[model samples]
Target: MTDPAYQRLGLPVTASPFAVLRAAVRALHPDTRAVRGFRAARKRFYRQMLCAHAARQAAGDRLTG
Candidate 1:
């Protein structure tokens, strides 16, 4: 199954949890420190990270159960 979160993070659904987290950190790192829209961008980044984490959990569950 193709996970949209993995696709957004440029990872495979079978990726390890550590890999997912590493990718999330790398992806979430902001290129700019602009004060404008910083709050909204931060919120989006956190949301994406959560989605990636959830995808990793779902993948692990499928493997274990």
Candidate 2:
């Protein structure tokens, strides 16, 4: 089965951990940095993205390690 974390991020399962992390960081970037409430939303989203990436990494290790 594919890692749902990668799927959620629209990345391939074969993507490296660095790629996943970069993607997660890139996702938080916005064209305009002045939106109201963006700070709070980004914080929550960042947490979720970290959790998803961690889950993907753990799952990959289980499958291959």
Which model scores highest in TM-score?
Answer: 2
lDDT of 2 by residue, 1-65 (tens): 54454466786556666777677667554653357667786666556666676677788789997
lDDT of 1 at 6: 49
Q: Residue 46 lDDT in model 1? A: 53
**What is the lDDT, from 0 to 100, of the residue 5 in candidate 2?**
43
TM-score of 2: 0.55
Task: Give, for candidate 1, the lowest lDDT window spanning 10 residues.
Answer: 27-36
The TM-scores of all predictions, comma-separated, are 0.47, 0.55
**Candidate 1 wrong stretches, greater than 4 Å:** 1-36
Clashing pairs in 2: none
Question: Each candidate: what lDDT?
Answer: 0.65, 0.65
